[model samples]
Target: MRRIPVRSLAVLATVGTLVLTGCGTETGDPADSTPAVAGADRTIRAHEVMQLTKVHEETGMTLLEGPTFDGTGKLLVVDVTAPAGKPKVIRVDVRKRTSQAVHTDARGAYTSAQFSPYDGRLYLTDYAHGEVVSLAPDGSDPRTFFSGDVDGARMNPDDIAFDEEGNLYVSDSRGLSTGDAHGRVVRIERDGKESTVLAEGLASTNGVSFDADYEGLWISELTQNRISYLRLDGKGGVASKHTAVRVDGGIAQTDSIAVDAAGNIYQALHGRAAMVVYDRHGERLATIEVPARAKGLESATNVAITPGGTRAYMTVSGPAGGFLYTFDALAKGVRQSNGG
Candidate 1:
């Protein structure tokens, strides 16, 4: 299929600069397009859906790719500085809709955050420093956990995830203009042993996650407008990999993703100011619309779900600075719920 182009394509790399550029010129065109669903031994429904409500304009914290919540229900977000400024991490109280700057350093820009399954510590990546650091929630001295230059890959560490076995996965996205075969996913073990390259030739793989069954891995391809799945056979690595879902009229720039308890996958389709949900079979279940009140969410980078599964938290970048929004998902047994 032709490359899906929505709202995410132009923002991932230029987010810091473009978010301040205003929600670009409106095209005045309809927002309907067909998406591609790819995978092994599976075929799924492919298309885009419309929103039933206006975009929620409420603001929380300024972050690039976050809203990651902890066991305590506290959501941590990314603050990519104030328009070409510095970077920091902010904590958002979901219950009160209030936020506080947990760690704001004018000298560093932290791109992504992941909580270690085995230790519960926070693992953060610095795009500019080419380093990954870990800090306790108590805000102690941040220590270098992993550091490597992405020079040969033409990429940087963006988002991260953890498998059921406590393994760490990092998404290495190629530069703005690059294509698949450039993005990389690296796996880090508990002993700090690292093995790189799970799948190669992905069109900007930025976010990744495994299904509830832990049988398959899902990755967000920013430049390809599709989610790829890799099946796990034994453990050493993925047995095979293939495209799982493609968003029609969707931007190739997909950033972050999360999978619910039922095998449903949630992906942030950046640039287009939208979130897409896909079933286990790779069908597009629903597309959550984001109102572009500011920079049109240059790169809607990360996604988080409350432990209760009642809402999904998203981070978007714009001229008004980075903002976060919560999407109310209907409770499972609540009849008459639209799953909105």
Candidate 2:
């Protein structure tokens, strides 16, 4: 198998930075401040007031992505250090402010790992291997849960999510360097059968999440710098689709996303160095800024809201190093079906 060259991957990595910093007018003037909440009488400057605490910091790790809470309240994150070193999943104890490796042997970079409510198992995306793997909640009993092809093409699963019925949805980002429109969102049935739900003109599908009401599936397209919501038919197929939110300028590369009980959407804006919050109607609510000069914490790649939604955990990756950060959230996160 021919690997996408590291240099090409680097080019893809820089897309967010260039879009966020180089695109003028798209971001507007930094001084032109406006209230985040629609129709609110007073402006709440969350970007300037929210305090961010460094939870865990590590050197030598290049890319950090995916973040989910375990049943025990520990946070699990993937270090996507491909070609340079073996990727591993690190488990963090939020209260203790400590972290440890709970799972290794990625075979390829691990993009996302989600716990299932029905079976009490961890489902992870093996990006380079084109498969989804499962593990015991404690990171044991690793096995391939789904692999091979989807819609007649290989899978490069980047993110995973589960519905109330226990079915799994995965975002397959075929490749980053190429401009081919091969991105797809696939569903793994309760019985393990796979089907493609959305596969049309997507440029590197990166994230997947369901709304609080379970009425729509939200996805982030990295290269396109937009997030969309897909209304699904009763039979696990897309009924209709529409753009929910888009990064107009200043680093439009949106990565992973999470939702709160109040229907607020938390998005990782890679190039802007911030996590953005949006109402269910796709209106901008707040911007949680991640410091740009923080040695190893440059880009915000993924976000996970804890069970109560009172706090949010984010992963930052860049040349300096990889680290996990946490901060108080304005809204409570919706509890996952599995109690994660």
Candidate 3:
């Protein structure tokens, strides 16, 4: 339902329309609106799994973003707001509730991370440098992997995903802040030699995750607070796409996203300290929020379901600092939820 003119109706030429496939869902007013994720599928009270930032930030606050599982079941997260002296990438021990540094570039602000199943290397998106860098599983051999461009314009990449065949898809999040259609979903070929703009013309593309079958993509556009399903053409490009879900509320923007084995989408909200679980059809399943006692935690920036199960961990941050919260997921975890 339209809470208040959430987005502009203008469409962009660079974007692929779902009208061709007749599967596109559009935003509507509350009077004629599609059912919003009313309250939630189930109100799940998440407990404190671990804390990364400080309880009270008398100085600077840490903004924790990406939360994903590496190959060996380590909970990896990124401090997008870390200063020079702090670790940008941190790996957590799920069993013991401990943390350790992975890697961080002095000049780069990495936002999201994923392990490439194809090559078994950890790939991270440096939002500040417009580059995708890779490191070994143990956080060694850090190097610039993909700084490719789209239509000759430098990409302000946000999040990333890898297809079954190893094609890298990125969310180019430079949107309204620059101009219309600047936001794009670019595909960097598996070989890393060529890149293509799979989709474009949006607000701010944030989350990037592939469907269970690898034939479609689930993307969240932040400025508009909506999520769309991008059906692939099977050759590393989007065939058609449609607006599948929209998060309507006060100043709430969608951040990172994860998909479980059954294809449920776990999307985080930056302004609100809660995560929404939506089915493949864009129906809301649950809303996982920190209990009222957990004060100072402002937002749930990103979430990752524990590999092989429904245990979900969210990377939260605010004036209280960065922290990790746990929840019982709606379905089993899969490749999409574990990776980036």
Candidate 4:
């Protein structure tokens, strides 16, 4: 391993400063703002605040996203190569802190990935190939799980998740593309079946997760600076959505989301250098800050959790490539509700 250049470090250092200062657009009046733990109903109260403890190297040429724990608690993450290389998914042994590439394909620029609880295998979304790939647990033998032709649409997939019954849900964001540029959320069943759209005309649907109870889908609209909830009829296939949290005029560009068993929502505030959390009803709970300056927290792009939600994992963008961060999920008090 070689040292990262000082110039790049300077950029990241600046982002860390901005993160501590004030990130996100400020909106609304004092009435809607409350200390997540203060005014939160007992139902939504966060019992613990976990702090991120660095688990592995955050410096490298690999851009990591879509992190999740396998049944054994090992962390599996997708590595999107820089402009010059192919995409690969790697598995990191949390206990050992060692990582190895499991699979790579040049035809697609993989964005986000997830491990299917349905079969304990890995599923990935590729913007370049316009489809999702299912990789064996060993990271070999990739297969197409679903594609746009069946859904009547095509866009870059930013993230993905599955329901209790093994139905696949995905967020399709039209990244930097022309013509409306709205994003979509789609559902595909385990047997390779497609359903009607969950929601459409979105502004940058990046990170997504199902509610802890598995009844609704929680989605993050990055450019819109807010999170939404969709009540799903996973059985009947009807999708009704609603706004969960509205962050007024805050900064946009959210990259990933994680949910604890308590129904608290966590977001990797990309371009903000902050990991934000919210109550189930959409109240801003806490904003956990990290050190990343240039490109705002190095675009703290993805987040994952250890089994039982005891720990959380995140990756940050680097001027040269990227770095990874791990933290205790429920540690200390959540960041001052209003930056006090």
- Judged by TM-score, which candidate is best? 3
- How well does candidate 2 score on lDDT at residue 238? 85
Where in model 2 is the C-alpha error above 4 Å? 1-61, 82-87, 336-340
The alpha-carbon lDDT assigned to residue 163 of candidate 2 equals 86
In order, candidate lDDTs are: 0.56, 0.64, 0.73, 0.57
**lDDT at residue 316 of model 3 (Cα atoms):** 76
Q: After superposition, how far is residue 63 of candidate 2 from its true place, in Å?
A: 1.5
Number of clashes found in candidate 2:
5
Q: Candidate 2's residue-wise lDDT over 154-270, tens digit each?
A: 777778878888788888776555756677888888567656656566877877888888877888887777888889887778889888888663634677777777777777766
A best-first ranking of the candidates according to their TM-score comes to 3, 2, 4, 1
Off by over 4 Å in 1: 1-63, 81-87, 149-155, 175-180, 250-252, 291-299, 330-340
TM-score of 2: 0.80
* Ten residues in sequence with the least summed lDDT for candidate 2: 16-25
User: For residues 1-340, could you state the per-residue lDDT of candidate 3 as single tens digits?
Assistant: 1112221111121122100000011111212212234335667777676777663231245677778788688888887756555687899997788999887655666778888878988888876557888889888999888785668887877788888777789988765343455688888876677889888887788888998888799999877789998998876667899999988736667887889888889888877788888888777888777766666766787888877787778787766668887767777788798756
Q: Kindly list the per-residue Cα lDDT of model 1 for residues 1-340, writing each as its tens digit.
A: 1222332322232323222111322222121223223332221111111111112122122346645776677777665432233326667775665766666553344667777767777777665444567778744667777775433543356666677566767776654444435777777675554645677767767777777766767887766777888887766587988887876644335667777766667776555556767777876666665543334345555566666555555666544445565554322211001011
Stretch of 10 with least lDDT, candidate 4: 331-340
TM, every model: 0.74, 0.80, 0.85, 0.74
Better of 1 and 4 by lDDT: 4
- How far off is residue 247 in model 3, in Å? 1.3
Q: What is the lDDT of residue 136 in candidate 4?
A: 82
